[model samples]
Target: MTERLTYYLLRGLFGLLARLPWVFVHGLCHVFAFLIGRIVGYRRAVIRANLSRSFPEKSLEELRQIERGFYLQFAYNFISTPKLLHQSPERITSEHFIMPDLTPLEEAAKSYDCVLLALGHYGNWELFSTGQLLLSTIGYSMDQVYRPLKNKALDRLFAEQRQRFGARLVAKDKIARHIVEYVRAQDGRHWLVAMITDQAPGIGHATYFTDFLHQPTAVLDGIERLGRKYHLPIFYFDIERRSPIQFVGRYVPLYDPKEGDLPNYTITERYARLMEANIQRDPAAWLWSHKRWKRPLEHYPNAVRSARLQALLDSAKDN
Candidate 1:
């Protein structure tokens, strides 16, 4: 009963917030950022620790600026996400997420059977999920593999927002089978599969590790594995906030199995490098509060398969 009331309250708040102009909402988000970072100090330690470990060269003062900037963008993403559902397609594309150079992705769609997008938790990722609407008009269909949140109401809310632009949201466990069936069913129609791969792999998920942001990171190998099996080319996005309310993104396609000979985990390593570069560029748009390196390498079940990664993680820890 209490949880139900809380859900209703949140839903009502979203409705009210969604009605406000973007500028008004932006101001409110600044306040939200200040409260969370300065007064509330919500996960400040985690954010600091993440920033410090990731960029060991940054001085204390430099890290603080990044932290503040991160908090501001973080609040903007949080506050704006709920309200985004009410925005028109024009507002979404024009003012919110402005992706101008989709030509490369379009070409990939034309050439590939299925294009797998390796994504991360960066700058208005929820908003970018709506890109399917734009791509679909050009004959490309989009689907994403996502692990639902614990709260059912919130999960439903996210699913509705992300699926608004016609992107299919498949459960993580069922994603592989779903993609296989999708590729088989679509025939000539191209399926663009988006998988946010940077988050710490949950139980029974990690299969590869790499040096990401100067720490031993366990990366999900599913995207690369599926790409190799299905002959799909992998792509990643470079998302940067143009302003408090706006973002610009470009797709960085990693490998073309048909064009080149690349080994396994090449897609995975490429994504890690691309994401790290983006983080280095902005240093704040990426989610720093996430415990990205929580799971140690030794805990992984397939140590022999991942021995190289394990050694890297151990070496990072030693120095």
Candidate 2:
């Protein structure tokens, strides 16, 4: 009962927030930044450590600049989500999302029976859900995979928000089976399976280790595995903020592997390289507060890859 009441209270508050003008919404986001940085201090230390390790060549001052920018980035993302909650499909597209050349995405959908896209947490990615006119016109329904938030009430709210514009949200772990069932039900309609997969996998779960953002990082291999399994075409999106409360999406087709044997986790590495390049382009926009190295190389015992990663971590940490 308490959780139910709290959910309604938050839902009401967010609804009110969504009704406000975009300028007002942005101003309110600054207030969020203050709260996040000063009061809540939401994982500021994690942001610091992640940035420091990710860019060891940079000095402390440079790293600090990125840190401050990331807070505001997160602040905007935080409020922009609720801003999207009560918005219409037309309003959401006109105000928030601006996709210039959807040709790549549409073409990818047409070329393959099914399409898979992996995105990093950058800009107002939530906008992608509400603002998918181009995607729908291309005859592609959206199937997004997300990790469920622990709080049941808040999780329900977020799930509702994402589903408002007609996306089918499936839990992360269940995505593989969900996709198979969903496709079978479609009876020939192809769907786009999109997921934000930049988070570090759980201890012993990160199957592909690579050098990303100047550190030996472990990335989940599900995208690659699924792509190969289904013979799906893969793409990456570089979502960027164009102006105050306005953002654009840039789509890049990722590497598709042949049936013959090649580099292991090739698609995963390509996606990471694309993501790393995107982060370098605008350091502030990507998610920094996430503890991306939950189980660094030191955690894996008796593994050949961990030894190499440990050396890289040591070298990077020292500098």
Q: What is the C-alpha local distance difference test score of each model?
A: 0.81, 0.76
Q: Name the 10 consecutive residues with the lowest summed lDDT in model 1.
A: 301-310
Task: Summarize candidate 1's per-residue lDDT along 207-267 as a digit string, tens digits.
Answer: 7777777776788777888888887787887887787668887888787877666766777
lDDT of 1: 0.81
Off by over 4 Å in 1: 1-4, 259-261, 298-319
Which candidate comes out best when scored by TM-score?
Answer: 1
Residue 204 C-alpha lDDT in model 1: 79
Off by more than 4 A, model 2:
182-186, 257-261, 301-319
Clashes of each: 0, 0
Looking at model 2, residue 178 earns an lDDT score of: 68
